[model samples]
Target: MEKEIYSLRSQFEIGLVTDTLVMLLDRGARVPLIADMPQVIPMLRGLLEGGLRHRHVYCRDTDGVYTEVVVFKERYDLELIESASQIRHFNRVLAKDSTL
Candidate 1:
């Protein structure tokens, strides 16, 4: 059987980050596993002064004080891959959007 790859894009508080993972189906159930989390926050920030706004974008401290991680979700898996690309097609898309 052929395997399907699903890209996962997360809306982190620090910034936007993307990762590629594989989706496995077992007994008609779908499961996903991440392969990488390429740090695209800096690159994304350059495009927009603020950051990506998403409902899931949040911060969670692990070790307490100075350690945290942001989370984001998307409807389609392909969108994640597209957002991960370094091409930067939508440069300054939020340049004027004060809300960010």
Candidate 2:
């Protein structure tokens, strides 16, 4: 199971929005594994709530530099989080309009 889980890790990415919010992004074409991985949710939450002593995920910052980010996964309702693609599309449209 460890090998399977590790393999699936590449299909998704996680981002920290705030101390109490997190964003999960699907990088693969397959259906998101979020629904299938129920056990991961509580583990993520525990790590977040447990404070800085826990391990962190390395992520790329806005400057394209990799940094260790502490994820706080407080919200479990997937419907409340917005997808990265939608945010990108909105930014593109906003930038286009601004140039006019």
Candidate 3:
């Protein structure tokens, strides 16, 4: 995570991505895994509600899955993230737009 992002998360009730999740942008993941993150993050958010804790998110890859534990801020935006299906569709549109 960037220092600025960490600061923002600390000061504001907003969302920020973890370093482990950040790597997913460069290295693609399995479709099911991609689809599952939104659901998982929310479940994790629910667990950490009103508490300071860390949750481990397992990244699924063709080789296998790797674990990345993230400390979600207490006020992380649970409603900001969209569902995996929505993400998939949005990404498809971006891909198409880039090709045009």
Among these predictions, the greatest TM-score belongs to: 2
Candidate 1 vs 3: which has more lDDT: 3
Error of 1 at 3 (Å): 27
Report the lDDT of model 3 for residue 67.
Answer: 29
What is the C-alpha lDDT profile of model 3 across 35-94, one tens digit per residue? 445444555456445323433333323333332335354323222233666456435643
Cα lDDT, all candidates = 0.27, 0.41, 0.35
RMSD of each: 16.6, 11.6, 12.8
Residue 63 error, candidate 1, Å:
32
Top candidate, metric lDDT? 2
Query: Which pairs of residues collide in model 3?
Result: none
Model 1 poorest ten-residue lDDT run: 20-29
Q: How far off is residue 56 in model 3, in Å? A: 3.2
Candidate 1 lDDT tens digits, 1-100: 2223233342222323323211111111122122123343333335343444442221222211111224343221222222423223222222222234
Q: What is the TM-score of each candidate against the true structure?
A: 0.18, 0.37, 0.26
Clashing pairs in 1: 11-72
